[model samples]
Target: MQIGYFLSCEEYAPESLIQQARWAEEAGFESLWISDHFHPWTDEQGQSPFVWSMIGAISQVTSLPVTTAVTCPTVRIHPAIVAQAAATSAVLTEGRFILGIGSGEALNEHVTGARWPATGTRLDMLRESVEVMRALWQGDFVDHHGEHYTVENARLYTLPDTPPPVYVSAFGDKAATLAGEIGDGLVTIPPDADLIRTFRDSGGAGKPVHAGYKVCWGPDAAACVSTVRSMWPNDALPGELAQQLSSPKHFEQAGQLVTEQMIDESVACGDDVDRHLDAFRPYVEAGVDVVHVDQMGGKRQGSELEGFFAFYRDEMLPRMRELAG
Candidate 1:
């Protein structure tokens, strides 16, 4: 699997994100994954810039391909609007942009006061929204009056030469089946071979699969874990807590239960090159086409963007390409 840097929109400001894009290209990362969240998971993260603007700025600074780690086109934003933003992004990046979409969490979607529908209903909305976006992308006036959304006399004129591919994010079998049926690719987290197998068996065979991982790197291993625990404890929350929590403060409360050991074991905490490599092995073994690493180390004082890139450039990139081969 190829390695790419994941820009955490929730953690860094727009300027830092842009600079990281440039450094990631120089560091030999093949692609970029930028989170598309409306709010930080916790106040500790402290940043959430509009992802479309960041993509435009990043395009001006680097030639690396960009994809939203995942966007929710279902509720917080309409699918037609998302289609337009995505088209403009593709143009800005010279057609090197992809639209990764998901069923979304209430944290972002509830801002519009929209009902946080049941999971099945949300998935259905996602599927219909995708239909709306794709139909609009064809450069024809789309009139869609589906069960959840209505579109009357809508057309997207500024589309990429080819429509941007949609990569659906799935965390369970039901979602995976829907993704295989509609998505051009699959976007999921961690490295579960069973999940990948389900996608393939559900008609996603040979499609690209992108998995996300979080890791920490710092001078002191213990400190690294502490930083991760402070900034990303939400990632280790059990079951559907990550999805059901409606507010950042709620997440922070739930995160209090997460232990340092959980963060250390799940994330490759510390600067050990071998440990970092092993963190990605499960994804590779699962046949993921791209492994997007979001370095949670930046919160630690010593772990700046340059240091992070240097670690990948001098230590990880070459070995990773060999593994990908």
Candidate 2:
């Protein structure tokens, strides 16, 4: 399986950003995936730089391909603008950029005074927005109307020779099927083999499937889990992710649900190579094309990367790649 790294770009300093990307690429990571969030999801977690500018810098700094782990085209940005931004980024990266998109959250989408649409409406909007984006990316003037968008005489002028592929995110059956039907690839976090099958059956060809899991490796595993729970506790629960995503005031109550046990279950927060491989097996079996290993060490302020990446590269990655091959 392909190995990739996920960064939030929460470190605002340009040198820090370039160093991190360069380190990951030099460490044997094949691709880079960055979070596209306007806010850090909480005040304790500071820094969310302008993602597009960061991507441009990343393109120049490292040879590894970059993708937005997931960007929302439904709310904060118009689909037409997303098409343009993506086309431009792809050109800058020289065809090494893939646009990973999804129906977004209120934390990022509420900036424009637009009311957060319900889940069903958001999915509907996601489908329509993608349709509009694909049409515009074809470099033909688009005159299209749909529930969420209407584009007239719109076409991307700075289009790439081959348009960047769209990778849709989904947490359930309906959305999974939609990903298969419309997306050239699927970007998912939950390692749901069923969803992968759904994507394949719903007119989705054998396309690229990307899945990521969090790992917090250090001398102190418990301390690492504590840090993870302090930030993103909901990830601990196995089947409650969809519910957490739909929670009305999820971020406000983030601290209440995240616990040490929860973090222990979801993250590879130990020194054991066997444990790390065990954490990654489900995604491999699910037929994931690319497996993103997010070194949650960034939360601990760079204490974990040296140990984690060393173990990952020398031990776990080779075994996993053997299994995948």
Candidate 3:
């Protein structure tokens, strides 16, 4: 399995993100994953930079392949615009980018004042969006009308030698199956072996499977847990609440339901190297081809962030490779 760093856009400014990309590449990460968000999950997280501009900066600084952990092409941004941006990103990165997409969350998309559809309808929109993007990536003018979107005489003038791979994010069987049918790869968070099987069974055989996990590496486990509980209580929110919550305030209110114990149980807190490995093993065992690790401890300064990368490079990445092998 390839190990990568997950850039939490919600917690870092654009320049910090570029610096982290450099640190991650120097520290031996093979690739990168970045969250795309219009707003931070809570006021405590404090920052959310535009992801495309960040991607442009990352392309200039790091040679490592980069992907949006998942961008929502179905709403807020039209598929044509996403297609153009993604195509430009691919060209800028000299083809080191992957367009990782999903059905989208209300937190970002709701800002456009569009009605949030049911899950099934959202999935349909996502399918159509992907289809539209793929059509535009062919480097020809595209004009079409679809169930959920329209493109009128639009074309991407600048194109990469090869279009970037499209990875679809899925959280359930139906979405997983849809990913199999259309995606060049699969992206998900948890290490659900059944989800992997579902994707593979439904025509995703041999496609790359990517997963992400969050950890807090520090001297004190309790302190780390406390930090995560305060900054990322949203991680512990259950079911579709994460995708359905419409605003940062709503998320902050919902996050109040999350507990320290829950955060401790879910996140790999503190500097226990073994604990970190244990957190990642489930994804490797579930057949994930790429594993992205996001360091969670609120907003970290350069020195602290460097320390985390150094620790992972020296103590964790080698063991992770061995375990995967």
Best candidate, lDDT-wise? 3
- TM-score: the better of candidates 2 and 3: 3
The lDDT values for all models are 0.88, 0.79, 0.90
Worst 10-residue lDDT window for candidate 3 reads: 297-306
Q: For candidate 2, lDDT tens digit of each residue in 200-279?
A: 89877779998887777777778777767665554554453333343324653755766677567668887777778888
lDDT of 1 by residue, 1-325 (tens): 6788999999998988998899899889989999999989999998999999999899999998898989999889999899999999999999999899999988888998988888999899999999999999899999998898989999988989999999999999999999899999999996878888888888899999988888777668898899889999999987777778899999999999999988878888878989988987777788999888887747446345577789889998887777777
Model 3: per-residue lDDT, tens digit, 1-325? 7999999999987888898899899999999999999888988888889899999989999999999889999989999999999999999999999999999899889888999889999999999998899899898889989999999998889889998899999999999999999999999999999999999998899999989988988878898888888888888888999889988899889888888998888889988889999999898889999999998863643355677998999999999999999
Clashing pairs in 1: none
Which residue pairs collide, candidate 2?
Answer: 233-258
Number of backbone-clashing residue pairs for each candidate, in the order shown: 0, 1, 0
Candidate 1 vs candidate 2, lDDT winner: 1
Worst 10 residues of 1 by lDDT: 297-306
Off by over 4 Å in 2: 10-15, 237-252
Task: Tell me how candidate 1 scores on lDDT.
Answer: 0.88
